[model samples]
Target: SFLSIAIGQETPYKAVVVTDGHQALETVTHVLVDLLLLDYTLPTMNGIELYDQLHAMPGLEATPAIIFTASLVKHQDVIEQRKIIGLGKPIELDELLSTIERLIA
Candidate 1:
């Protein structure tokens, strides 16, 4: 739901949406290797765990990720430990944009 709006706003470029963390992991082999990886995922493997894996890979450590989750309260330990920008659910447009701009800037 939220990703669609973000991709639309950033369009004229390509967009690939992976529905699950497992699929995302698999796609990383074929799709992510060719692009700049920007992640926003929840639970399952969680963002930081996925990011940690990506960082250890040869060419992905420097890639940036924005951790979007509905479980902020539950995952405070993981979020804080990783220094991730937690974009909470309910999607506040301004805050999301500000975080993205700050990250990309």
Candidate 2:
């Protein structure tokens, strides 16, 4: 909720916060999600795994995503191959906003 509120205040985008990958998938399936900003420490599945599941859905493969993680190097290869940005945790708000702007532009 804090993340959603912060992004909403800073941008035109409406952020939806989900507890885990399951809720994330369910929410996006019903709602019109323009972009995905996922945290690596989700409850059930990790952010990268969730990304794969989300992309597997028909017509959502091209959606933009950014995965936040403290140990980004651990998943660098997959992140690079999938062309998804792996933004380290404790991300600067400005940097995050700029990245979102660039992706959604």
Candidate 3:
């Protein structure tokens, strides 16, 4: 949680954390998310797979998402293919806040 705490302090939006991609999928099924901040190395299914699935769902195809990773070398192609914003790990709080604000705006 550092990101959640930081986000809470910086914005009115609440951060809902899910342990893995499957949980994320389940959560999204029941909730309408304004933005998605996904880690690339998620358990069960990776971020890209989860993103693809989410995008397939009605009303979510255009949802803005930020995919973060500690290692991006292996995921660059998929990230570009998805046309989603990718952020390197140890993401700056300012940048994250700004990105979220922009996406949700």
Highest TM-score scorer: 2
Per-residue lDDT of 16 in model 3: 89
Which parts of model 2 are misplaced by more than 4 Å? Answer: none
- Indicate whether candidate 2 or candidate 3 has the larger TM-score: 2
Best candidate according to lDDT: 2
Clashes of each: 0, 0, 0
In candidate 3, the residue pairs with backbone N, CA or C atoms under 3 Å apart (3 or more residues apart, or in different chains) clash, namely none
Each prediction's RMSD over C-alphas, in Å, is 3.6, 0.9, 1.2
- In lDDT terms, how accurate is model 2? 0.89
Task: Sort the predicted structures by lDDT, highest score first.
Answer: 2, 3, 1
Q: On residues 10-40, what C-alpha lDDT tens digit does candidate 3 reach at each position?
A: 8999888999988988899898898989998
Q: Mind giving the per-residue lDDT tens digits that candidate 1 earns over 80-103?
A: 776666667766767766665565
Among all windows of 10 consecutive residues in model 2, the one with the lowest summed lDDT is: 25-34
Residue 20, candidate 2: C-alpha displacement in angstroms: 0.4
Residue 50 alpha-carbon offset, candidate 1, angstroms: 2.2
Rank list by TM-score: 2, 3, 1
Segments of candidate 1 deviating more than 4 angstroms? 10-14, 30-44
Return the number of clashes found in candidate 2.
Answer: 0
